[model samples]
Every structure is written in structure tokens, then in C-alpha cells.
Target: MHDQPWTTAPLVAFDLEGSGSQDHEHEAILEVGVVPLVDGHPDIRNAYDSTVNPGRRIQRRPWSSPGLTNDVLGLAPRLDAIEPELAGRLNGTSIVGHNVNVDWRLLSPRCPGIRPASLIDTLKLARLIHRKAQPRTLTALLAYYELDDEVTELSGGQPHRALWDAVGAGLLLGALIRELPHGGSLTVTGLHTVAGVSLGDAEQTLPLF
Candidate 1:
């Protein structure tokens, strides 16, 4: 793998809280958080998070962490209302997240015009680094790296909230990058190759509006 630093480019790490997992059906995004990273560190002052009215009841899943509920999202603005700001955050930046495909599936339909230049899936990266580790969820990876303590000190101290997850993902990415063999850094193309997917290609395959 080429040892080019990926942080030289603008990176936006984001997360989406959705009503459910079945994006093809009634599932919709309930909240979104975006954190722009500068030279491999999150710029919290410019971070963005918003509760989105999913236009349907927010389904509670057994696997989902607690916090999001119909009551919490009842008064939130709809996706269309926040589309402008959300798009602005995503525009012209590489994307990063844990299991980011899920976020893209739910987000692309809502903001068709904003297509990321590339993507770095932390889920995939974690597996690549720690192939034998079981249950490679974000929480598990954070704990494995001994980064959970820092995450717990975050503003909300909650796990599944959009902003918290986004920040956690960014931190996890930094840790993973540092652990790269021989002090190596990943290029955008290198990340895409390892991820075996591209946000640009995924966006093109999206249903035409």
C-alpha cells in the first residue's frame, strides 16, 4: 500500500441515526452529525448535528441503542428543511464512518446532489487490521483500542447518538491510521481499494430522481 497521508485532503466524518435498517421500505433518517477533520483531527467547533423528522414513526430495534424515540424526534425538522446545510457539510470532502454504507443508503436519497469524492469505512478498516477480532462493531473497536474512556467523556456520554458516533468514528480512524504498519499512511485510492467500494460509484447507482 502506498504511504501517502490521507489527511492532506479535507475529510468529513459523519453518522446517521435512522428509524430503521430497511432503507428500501419505510426507514428514514432521524438525525445526522458531521465533523470535519483538519490534518487528521476533528474540528469540533465546526461540527454539525441535527434532528431530522423522518416523516414516519422512529422504529425501535432491539439492536439499536436507546436515546432516539418518537417523542425526541416529534418536533424535529424534516429532511428537506435541513438538506441545504447537510449538503454544504458533505460537499467536496472525503467521507468516513463506521459501516458507512448504511449511512449512504439512507442519506443519498435525501440529498441526491451531494456525492462524496471517496469514502473510508472504519468497519472494513478495523477488520483489515484485526482480522481475528470478533464483533467488530464501533464500540468493540473503541474498547479494543482502549479509546472508550475518551469517548465516554464526550459531551453527551451517549453511544448511539449521531454526533457522538461521528466523533468516535473519527477518533477510531486516527488510532487505526497510527497503527498502520511501518508508520504508513493511506491515500484516498488506497482506502477505496481496501474498502472494495466507492461512494462515487454508489451514488451513481442510486435511483434517478
Candidate 2:
């Protein structure tokens, strides 16, 4: 499968909004969104978005300021309740995210036995491909690639939210793929190379705005 072209790979754009803590171990995921790539295209119509009710009180506002408060989250389903659904969708697919490691960390513990086919971080790709690009925030990359407007129009939610960011990351993947020398002719391994060999190396090279 690694030798398969990226466009044919089962890549899903995954993202989540967390409740207050910077420490992944302590924080709780408040929302999750998955935009599955259909032939390398974001399938927004079939995208999954769900708000998760944190079991405990959120100590502070989430970094994204998603406005997911106790009152709001209390009405949502707990992580375990949706674990089956989550596992079914995420288990067998390779997930792509702007800073995927964080989401993986936040999610792995909550949903055990849920493993993805691969993890492709766009942040790492930007570090290697567009080294000079300043402030590689997902929004910045989207704007630079002229995809911000289209992402906003297609995503049902707003920025800082799960669904919107998932769409942004998904489309951003397509944009970056076109920037490659081989275009859509590249393999999944080629895409991984863009993410770099060292897991945490590319992350240290670029800081999101």
C-alpha cells in the first residue's frame, strides 16, 4: 500500500477540538471531525462531526476558543459511547492532519485499540516543501494556496471548530500534493518522505502562527 499512488490511498483528514489542557494526558477531546478522501478529494458531504462531552469540568477555555462550554458539552455523548463509531471509521485508514501527533495523542488514550494505517502530518510537509513560507498555520497555508474561501464555503462550521479545520486540512493536502514535482503521480511513500524521517524533527523546524 505504501507503493500505491497517494490519490489511491485511503487517506482521511482527521481533527479534533480539545477541552482546556495543554497536557494531552489531562485534556479531553470536545469534538472530532473526519473528512475522508474520496479518490484524493475531500468528501465533505459525508464528513463526520461530533461533539464529545468531557466527563469532568473544563479548567480553562480551549486554545481555539471553540466555545464548547460545560453546558454545551454536557448534552453531547461521551467518548466511549462513540468509540465503536470512531473505531469503525478511523481504524483502517491513514489519517492526515496539520499537526496530527497531537490529535493522535489526545485520541489514542481515549479510544484504545484504534490504530490508523498511517499518520501524515502536513506541518512536516510544509517544513520540507515550503521551508521559507512564514507562519504555516493551517489558515495561512489555506490562504496562500487560495483555498481558504472554498474551505469556508464548503465546511458547515466556522474556523477553530472541528469540521471546518478538517476540511481545511483535507483540501490543503490536495493543494500541497499538486505542488509536488511528481504531482498526483507520486506514491504514499513519497508523501511520507515529505513529512520527514524523524517523527518530531519537522515539528521543531516550523511553529504555527
Candidate 3:
């Protein structure tokens, strides 16, 4: 292990964009993206993204985003088809992402057996590190940390597509981790010490991460 909270832990930045915000609601998962990082940086070529069949008719109403459509998802696998693979990659890894709770809520149930021991949120990390910064979107943080060049080019073609966003998130975290004042005080026990809670706890000790 690398000694940090996520040391020796394979990292996967995952994202899920959906038609609606319900775990078991009528809406569907529009897209899912995953970028696995080893030793802090994205492997790039190994990224995964998929549009899924919701098993029901996709809403093609005016309120829907153009990107969320049956046409986009027509060729993609159903949610059930991809669940096994997603669960396998996610097992025992430290998951990092921007607004990761959304992703977890939508997909975690499909992988009921896997319990991530650690999680790092770039969104929370950004607020913690740059509380005084003027702007704080993921893109802004990328620029602030001089990481825009590394990731901006990757997501350019797909933009908001789930997988590309996941990769961008991985890049963002990689940049933030490297830019930390001293690589951050990131030991597993140390994090538990300061967080005042264990990773296996069902709920967070504090409302915020």
C-alpha cells in the first residue's frame, strides 16, 4: 500500500447521467462512464462509457436534453448487461469523482456486493483546498491547477458524455492530488482519525465530506 488513505488502491472515477434523479423511479440511466486510475493518473486508453437501455420507452419530450434519447442509447447495452463488468472494476477501489454521490446512488444498487472502503470527492476537495477561490466548477478548478491542458483536449469531442466526464474528473483529481500542499495527509487511519468515522460506516459522521 502507498500509505495514504487510498494507497495502493486502484482508483476509478465514475459518472452517471440520468433522465431523472430517482433510484427506482420511472426514469432511466442516460449514460455511465468510468475512468480507472492507477498511481494517480488516468490510464486513458482503458476508459469505459456506455449508454444504457432503461428497459422502458425513453422520454422524448421537450424537457429532455438532446443527448438523452433512444437514438443515443439504441446501440448500447441494457443496464443489466453492463452491471457485472462495472461491479468487477469497482470492487475494493477508492472511487474519486465530482459530485460522486449522484453516480453512486444510481449504480451502487446494481453492485450490491461491493463496498468501497474509501472515497475522495474532487468537488469537496476543491472546496476544502480553495475556499477562497473565486470560481469553482470542475473546469475552473482544472484551469486553476493548470490541468486544463491535460484533460480539456480529451473531452473536447464528447463534452458532457458520461465517460468523458469521468475521465475529466480523474484528471481533475490527479491534478488536485499532485498540487496538494504536501500530497495531503492521506493515510487510512489518519483520515479515520480526522473524519472521526470509519469508511465502512453506513452514514457519514458529518453531513458534508
Candidate 4:
């Protein structure tokens, strides 16, 4: 056999929820959640979550959201405090996420030291795996893979808790990776071409396997 491709890449399934809207650039990441994986299993010991104080006030734009506020982020840690740990975990790993690019923009500036060579996006993977799906959001995939029961209990009220969502993402990743042809061994350059991402690096793409 191919030795199961997902197990080939050292992946870190992650998610980032910004303080404001989903526009991302203007809306700073209030919380970041990471679930590191090695050899097809969740590396619970290495998992991490952090809350970033985006410096500017987290405005609750009524147009997009009504209940969201800065109060939800009051207890989260600032970016400076979380940088060391963030750099250590993300230094050289393949990132797998619902939409890896969105998480990248939220995470990159915080740690100038970390640059991942490979990225596997579950969103893009969904498209490659299923051609006729209506949409490929996290919820959609959860249902598509019959993982709805696994995550439905988590869907009522939690807006942006980092650790909570991180745990959930870890579970979802465990399920999602099974759907990929190569468990998770997709290249950053290849994903960029598939996702139309501008991976601005003049370096050769590394072998994720």
C-alpha cells in the first residue's frame, strides 16, 4: 500500500476566529487554536491555544454581528505572551485547516520566525474529493462525513473560545484526514495552485512526505 498518505505529513490542524468581522485583514485574530498531529494521531501533549489582544479595540460591527463584543475576549492572552509557544509548534510543519490561508493571515504577523513549507486545506480537499457538493464549510463537511453527531452538541452558543474549538477541530481533523486520498500529504505549492493562493515564496517546495 501507499502507507496511508495522511500519516506522511506532520500536520497541525488549526483555526482562528478574529475579534471583529470575517474580512480578516482588518479584523484581528482574538483567538487561535492548534491541534498538532504526528503519524496520524493527535499529539495532545503538543496542542495549544491562545488569545491575542489585537491592540486596537474589538468593535462589534452591528451590520455583521449583534452579540459579539470585546467582552468575549477579555480573558484571552495577548499576542506577545503567546509568540514563543506559537513559533515552537509552527516552525516547520504542514498546516491543515478548514481554510488554511485564513488561519495563516491571522497567525503569520504574530510569529515572524515561523514559515510552513506545506499546507493541506480541508476546504480544498473537500472540492478535490467531492465534485458536486454545494459548499465545503466546516459544518457542511461535518455533515457530509456523518460527523454531525460528533459536533452538533457544540453548535448552540459558543462564539469564539479558542481551546474549545481547538479540541473540536482536532476531532474533526481526525475524521477529515481519512477522506483524503493521501491522508494529508498535499504540498503547499500544489494547494496554492488548487486554491488560487499566492504563496509568495521563491523557494522550492519541500517534500511533505
Candidate 5:
């Protein structure tokens, strides 16, 4: 098990905009954004964003509110085309995001060989820290921290874009880490334990690649 303190480790917070909620075999990833962190701080200069063609037309659903339309994706590269670059970014870094399981489900099958060193779900982190904070969505968490305006500025006043959400998720992770009660330092394994059995089996430390 990698036992590095999360505060000092290199991490990557990412977000995905997919065609739908359920991870059906046919469902496709529409957009992906990655923000790399050094010592728990976002390295915005190296952030990455890409639009992926799911090999099929995106079906619009009430629950799905993707910023990219099928027409936009028509000109984008396929998943296989960018898997090499994406894999390079994810490998050897601890992964962080809000409701990250959805992103993992959409990404792992596409990139069979990439495995993150660890994983942190900000949505789960928030629940563990502040259970009474109503509407624990990313938007709500940003608002809770008075960061909604800052996110708007970061994304050129846009929300739901993968890059924007990735940046926001990274910022939220930093804030949550700061909020941790002082004592022994926060480690990747410790955070995973707090995430509990409902997340997955305790022994499965590495994320689904």
C-alpha cells in the first residue's frame, strides 16, 4: 500500500461529462477534464480537457445536461485516439473528484492499462466531514465554501464544463484537506477507510483502471 500523506503527494482531480448517468456498455464519455496537483495544490498551467466521440450519437435525456452537443462531438477525437495521453496523466497519481465513481466507470474500460495510485471522492469526503450540509453536489459545496463566484471566474462564468468542474473539484479537495482536524496527518489510506465499505471492498485500495 502506498502510504504517502495526501497533503504532500501528487494528485489529479478530474471530472467527466458523459452521455448518460447509467454506465451501460453503450454509454459514452462526452468530455473529460483533468487538473494535476502538486503537494495538494492545482497546477492549472498543466490542466487538460478533451472532447471524446462516443462512437455513437449522444441521446439527450432529462437527467443528462451535457455542455457539448452531438454536433460538437462530431468533430472530436475518439476515446482510443486520446487514451495514450489520458493514461499518461492518470498513471502514478492519486485521483480526486466529486462523485468520482461515475467518472471511473466511464473511463476504466476505455483505458485498460492505466491505474491511479489512490482515489479520493470529494462528495464522500464532504459527507464524512459535514453531513448536515444540504445538497452535497459540487455546486452546493462550492457555494458552501463561498467559492461559486471564484469557479465562475475560473471557468469564464461557465459551469458543467469538464475542465471547469475539474478545477472546482481540485479546489474543494484542498479546502476539505485544510478542514481536517489537526493530529496525525491525513493519508490516502486513511481517507479511503473513512469512505467505508459502501464505496467498495476495503482491501481494494487501487482504483479500477
Candidate 6:
């Protein structure tokens, strides 16, 4: 799995909208989205997205989860109801997201037995590709690459939503993969030096081939 290039190995880009909490322990997932990548393109046809009822009121924050009211969230499935589907799509797949570990920290505990074969952090990739780029957030990075419109069209939803961010991360990944400094084709393992799961590991970029 480590040696497989993203162009060949399967990748599942995912995002989890949480209960507006910074601490993973307190962050209940409000929604989830996953889009598989094929040939460097997001296959939205097979995409999975749903609002998961947190079983409690989601604290309101400015722009946290726009238009998702308690009434709306209450009607959605609980995490346990969707656990199998989430694990089916995520486990053993190469996972991609802007700050992926954050999602993992929140997701892994709730969905036991869920794990990924590899992780790619587009936030780290953006810094490596464009050192002087400003505001490396997912929204900013998509705009930086001029991919915002396409991702928006593909997602058909606004930012901060799981599906929209999933599609954005999938597209952002394809763009970043093309701009990698490595010569010729690159493998999933090759991106680890700059886009490893943790911030500390991603900071150490020694030659690895």
C-alpha cells in the first residue's frame, strides 16, 4: 500500500462536521462525507454524505454549520446507524483531507475498528508546493489553485459541510499531487515526507524515495 502511487491505489477523501468543539473528546460528529478518487478525479457518483444526529443540541457558532438546525439534525441518523457504511468506505483506503488527523481523532473513537491504510494532509502539501502562499486553509488552498469553482460545482453545497469539504480535499489532492517537487511519478509513500499524518512528521522533509 505504501508503494502504490495515488494514481493507481484507491483513495477516499473524507470530512466530518463536528459539534463545534475543538476538543476531540467532546466533539460529536454532526455529519460525515466521503468521496472516492479514481484516476485523480473525485467519483461523486459513489459519494456518501449524511447528517448524523449527535443526540444532543449542536452548539451554534458563527458559520460552524450554516442552516443545519437542531430540528434538521435531529431527523438524521445517529453515528451507530451509519458506522458500517463509514467503515466500509474508509477502512483500508488511502485517506485524504486538508487536516486529516483532526477528522481521524474525532472519527476513530466513535467508529471503533475504522482505520486507513495511509493519510495525506493537503494542508501540509499546500505549504510544500507554494511556500509563500497565504491562508493555507482548505477554502484558501482551493482558491489558490483556482479549483474552487469546479469543486463547488461538484459538491453543490457550501463550505464547512462534510460533502463539500470532501470533494474539495479530493480535488485539492489531485492538484497538489501534480505540483510535487519529486521527479516523474510519485507514490503515496513519497508524499509522507511532506504530508504525513501528524504536523511534526510533516515538518521533517528529508529525501526519501
Superposition error at 43 for model 2 (Å) = 0.5
lDDT of 3 by residue, 1-209 (tens): 55655444567887777776432444467788777887667776787777887776675655454476776678778888887777787777767777666566555555566577566677766666676855567666767767666675665434456766677788877565555665565654432232222244334321221
TM-score of each: 0.86, 0.88, 0.77, 0.70, 0.84, 0.88
Question: Cα lDDT of model 1 overall?
Answer: 0.75
RMSD per candidate (Å) reads 3.6, 3.8, 4.4, 6.5, 4.2, 5.5
Report the lDDT tens digits of candidate 6 across residue range 1-209. Answer: 66876567678889988875553356688889999999878999999999989888877878577767899899999999999898899888878888887777667767876767778788878887777847688998888789889988999998889999999999998888788666247876676666767523333332121
Off by over 4 Å in 2: 59-64, 196-209
Count the clashes in each prediction.
0, 0, 1, 3, 0, 0
Tens digits of per-residue lDDT for model 5 on 1-209?
43767666667888888776454565678888888987776777788888988778877776665568788899999988988888899987767888787677667766777677667788887887886746688988888898878766765535688888888888888787677784147776676665312323322333333
TM-score winner, 1 or 4: 1
What lDDT would candidate 5 get against the real structure? Answer: 0.74
Please write out the lDDT profile of model 2 over residues 75-158, one tens digit for every residue. 999988888887888887788898887777677766876777678888877776787846589988988898888988888668
TM-score of model number 3: 0.77
lDDT of 2 at 86: 79
lDDT of 1 by residue, 1-209 (tens): 23466777678889988765554545677888898988877777798988887777756778554667788788889898998898788877778899887788668867887777767788887787777746588888888888777766752546888888888888888888776673355775565666534665454543322
**Where in model 3 is the C-alpha error above 4 Å?**
2-7, 22-24, 60-66, 184-209
TM-score of 5: 0.84
Deviation from truth (RMSD, Å), model 1: 3.6
How high is the CA lDDT of each candidate model?
0.75, 0.78, 0.64, 0.58, 0.74, 0.80
C-alpha root-mean-square deviation, candidate 3: 4.4
Off by over 4 Å in 4: 1-5, 21-24, 61-69, 151-209
What ordering of candidates by lDDT runs from best to worst?
A: 6, 2, 1, 5, 3, 4
lDDT of 3: 0.64
Best by lDDT: 6
Q: Which of the two, 3 or 4, has more TM-score?
A: 3
